[model samples]
Target: MKTHLYKMLLAAGIILFSISSCKKFGDTNIDPTRSSNMDPSVQLTTAQLRFSGDLNVNERTSFMMTMPLVQHIAGSYSNRWGGIYFNSPNVMGVLWEDSYGSDLVNIIDAVKRTTDVAAQSNLNAVCRIMKVYSFARMTDLYGDIPYSEAGLGIKAKFDTQAEIYDSFFRELTAASVQLNTARDAVKGDIFYNGDINAWKKFANSLHLRLAMRLVKINPTKAKTEAQLAFNAGVFTSNADICKTVHEDIQNPYEEVGKGNIKGNGVSASFFNGGAVPGRFTTPFLNQLNSTNDPRMKYMVKNYVDLPGGNPLNRIDITEPLLAVTGGYFGVNPGNYIWDDFKSAIAITVPGVGAYSALNNDQKAQPANFLLRFNAPFLHLTYAEVELLLAEATFRFGATFGGTASSHYQKGIEAAMLQLSLFPGGPTIPSTEINAFLQGNALIAGRELELINTQLWITLFLNGPEAYANWRRSGFPVLTPGTNAEEPGESLTIPRRFEYPYTEEEQNRVNFEKVLPALGGVDSWNGRVWWDKL
Candidate 1:
């Protein structure tokens, strides 16, 4: 967890200024300094750090909630079940805090600071792009939010989801145009490192994602915006993917690990220690196994051996390890439940070995290999762009000069390439990748479903986007797990998380105004405006 040099310098400078000002000031009649100023680059850097941290936090939280709702993993206990069943308001509130309290606020301040600096136009454009990205994510998660007038000291008004999306498109468009006219390089851009062109590509790529999200609710607008984004030039390759580099800041996963490890030594990276030794869902493993997806090996760890020596050393050796017998079984969602501290091994069926979870070979290492400290916080990727293009071409007759299959193949290739970034992660050989593409070709009748399902798989570790895609596209149809706590409620998957409770108490007027549009009360099943399906 190395601190950034700039952060250290900034802190030292602040302390020095405070001491020097204290020594010099004795003038009551002459007005003491009332104005404060910050370098736009410093503001940009702070905003980028806050935004990336928020994104990581959001993704990690979503893994416990939406990932299981979509059946990517299974909950083994009552508390773990909260995420799946939408029973934990406090646990879900972090998403709201991260987006609004941190990223959105810092980004607005950055925009204000950068506005008048012509030399900092590139940084200003990046700020605008990030503001749109942050707001779009907020609207997607909570429906109407404080967007148009959010972050101002005055009482803010909530904007409709449609209005927010419209503003996102306009902001991205304006940012892209501003980027094109940039005269100076950007600094403190954690995602793109002063590359204005890459920032432009990010803006357009994000626009495409936002546009496609509107497809089900507003097909005409979706098609038009998608085309505009395409014409504006989205990611051209994996090289153009936007992600924050982690050279100095500590990874959020490392922080989670520190708070969650118990005497058993199971890393919190394995489901944040919610469900003992969290196991992948049966459906998720089955999809990979059936497709012979090479990614499965990298993403999942077989329970062949346990760290700190085998706890089952005394068990009879007649029965084979579960990995040997059944080849790494995932817990079937809702099939079994138990209290925490109950051995994960005890729940396993005979000859199936202990349930498989994420690989923990690097658990003792400084940075978890699978969840590396230095791993980039992905914002956009060429893989996603190509997949979206494949869908757009098929649905809108988009003239990107390629067939759906070509875009699909490129997407698969890029996704495979992207995984190489994980420290000590597995690499899929070219032959295996080609075989996967050959077997999983986009058939004419089921192209949309197949493409979106693959998108779901590729979007692993990117939970919010995956959840949004699942909502809008309705692909990879998953059955909601039965929850005993909410037995009277239907098992339909939640459409969106409820607004944070603080909003109701603190921002009562605005919160109340938005509640009717959110189905008179904030409930998990209430769908956002773009979620027409």
Candidate 2:
């Protein structure tokens, strides 16, 4: 009765979160808080938690679309939108809907409530940075969006991507300065627990990321902002990684998979049924195995899970071929859908156990993985910031700070070491890491490709960001999936997702205003402003 009652309560929580998440904010993001007494700290916590755990958004946007789109993982029906480059309307527009409707509504209101209040000043600054982050993610994927008048209860016209990028730099600059230890501590901050300095570092580090996106469009401005962020002190070590720490909850897969619980979305989405998780992509495995990357063993393994949503139903299994092959394998994107998934597992090779899936630690399989419910999901990391610094230094000059090669090494090393942040996560043997590093030292001529490829590898599970980086930096060049796919859409990987098809009908007047910039039509082929050809 106790267990049953607890599950019932959790189910109720998930349902509420799902229903509330779907609430429309009308023409633009109408302020969620009409009452004056509404607490901004509560709002901050709400936005942070929802942003991280909104499986509806993460699963569709990251897990389904971007992950497979980038060849990180594939082979399930869940991955087709991106894995095979199909143009699904809801899949393309879900991020826009959730951000404007719920996540943005809360954080925008939180900033309004806390702005200039002495006790809430630090909180306000954090909200400001988060606001930039939410909007940045929006623009990175769908460029030239409704920004200036959004959430103002007016018909919102699209803002050019250049204008949006300007706001990102400006807001990040102000927020980083506004964060001060002398001010009152922040409340409801999941990333840093009210630590003003950490938030400050995160803001500056994020500034570096957004700046790097401009390498193709405007190198001068990118150089300026990148150097400014480096001087302002971005994350210098693993301790400063900006990630969301989720609550350790009962039935995390059950609760979070349903979209209400405060748990890791990546984990929940990847292991939705806890029976068949998507396989590591063949291209991804090649990157690891070819280099004898030590992270391979930690990345994927064989597991045979009985048909159930409970992780406990999974049986530990291994592949004898791992030693010779140096890793387990995955099908090409879109090669194995629902029926193939069943057949593949049923007729597994004699020596290879069951099909390959993400390692036990990443999946959170009970005794095998206490890391599940509470594993910290990566947002921005020291690894990413260091790599950006490496890229910036390589592109511009030494003014951005350390030598590109040195930062490149630091970035790679940080990525290997930081996996331990996950409960029982990999502590890559230093000997192995050092060996990989020495063997793959930065070659002079191919600096750009090598640096961004490392960035691609480090950005394993965060699909949207990976997609953005790939578009902007053009690293680890991916080929379009060869599986039979939806015909009308671009056979090549899409450069950008079109605006929600509803925008054409519902907000036709305002929507049509941005069409000229979109080459007179709302299509993925029309590139974002920063995404220069």
Candidate 3:
């Protein structure tokens, strides 16, 4: 499901290959005409596509690693346990390549193309906003990164995480102002579709998110930026949420799910035949089950035991081969002793399935609700904004004209309504929503814990954000995976991903220079600058 942007990239790749092939072996003369310049509009489109694709790839990568580390899901037989236990370097490297190589570089190129052009001032502002978003994610994941000198040639050096965060605050603030002043509309903006006002909101919303990250480390700066973001206007409702809608291009999550089921991608351990490699974790399911959260049914599917036939063993069948109760079972995180397919199928109830899988519903035919190929890839949501505002009100006592309770309820309501966007998602009745909200009132003393936990639940499938918040807030105290205490590794959950091996091999000098700041070792135990108490 490639889009026009992807086709352009493909064509460019082919053209480059052809030009290289035409050059005689060891030819000394370089062809000046063999240029690869694109117009600002084309470059902007490419950047937007790359950014959206990077988000999808990041989400999939996190599902295999951080998702388990945070106990959202657990592996049954595969090396996913290695991820939960902090032993997966290859998985972490994908995120580095996608963000730096694909996302950031394209955004940088687009921003460069639009610079000094009066007509493209808004486009330039949009590019800057995207660049900040990309760089923020990179710094958040790994302490120091190639920021200031990134996307330039080989001699690029790493910028300290603090420096990167400072630039993010400045860039977002400037971009917000520029967006407000520029009257020109941006072209090729897939996220907001030329809506300068929406882009402004997104810029400020992203600013708010980055500011909150500094709450523990720099309260003064956090308060300042948070207030700035409020004045600039962040997301106020679902209409203001930032997402890239899937059109000609398929959702990356859907592709990942298909590959997993086909045994060609990350092993998810769902009953796709043979041995199950992973399943939802007990803690994750328990939280939703106990709360009677309507989203549970929308987000997960009960394990169905089938009599076997097709090799793919697709789980999205309309009619179950076998029906049973208590089929939805979650594995305990860190416990690798559980048998795979055998254990999942060992059901006592006559007509009940034994284990649950993350939702693989096919009620809407080609669109699989949560796993739909055309599902919107969300960046920021009104729900998150409301929750963050609630936290700001509770922690810093910023006057937002409402108490934390009001913001919390608004967040919950927005989250519930947000799920309805899925094609075949459950209709969360007003009754269930009200019941959950009433029963889960934010107590004055335990407001932080409740807010963070609810944020965790709302940010499902958003592993990086959830992991970052958990690191910062330390709410709903989670236990390390069973194998976390393995020899030579720290028992604590990983604070950051180690730098990719390519950096060590190709940019050894610059990489070594940053080692001292990373505790003189590129290891997962090293914390980023903002992950402070």
Question: Which tens-of-lDDT digit does each residue in 14-85 have in candidate 3?
Answer: 433333343333211122122357555544555454444443344445555666677776653442533346
Off by over 4 Å in 3: 1-36, 52-56, 76-83, 180-182, 247-278, 305-327, 336-368, 483-490
Model 2: per-residue Cα lDDT at residue 301: 59
Residue-by-residue lDDT tens digits, candidate 2, 20-96: 54454444344443556766666666667666677777778887788888888876667777887778878888788
Angstrom error at residue 422, model 2? 0.6
Report the number of backbone clashes for model 2: 1
Tens digits of per-residue lDDT for model 1, 1-533: 13453563353234323322432332111122322665556545555554444333443455456666676655444225433474566656666754454346557767877786887787888999988887776678778878767666545677889888988899899899998543887765667777888888999999999999988999889989999999998999888988765542232343321221111111223333223334566678788889888877667654333322222221222123333345655555553323121233332435555543223311111113444434556767899999988998888884865888999999988888888766555567999899999998989899888888888887875667888888999988777766454452436777887776777766778789988877698887889999985
Q: By TM-score, highest first, what's the ranking?
A: 2, 3, 1
lDDT of 3 at 343: 21
Cα deviation in Å at residue 489, candidate 3? 4.4
Task: Give the 10-residue window scoring lowest on summed lDDT in candidate 3.
Answer: 257-266
Candidate 3 similarity to native, TM-score: 0.81
CA lDDT of each prediction against the hidden true structure: 0.64, 0.74, 0.64
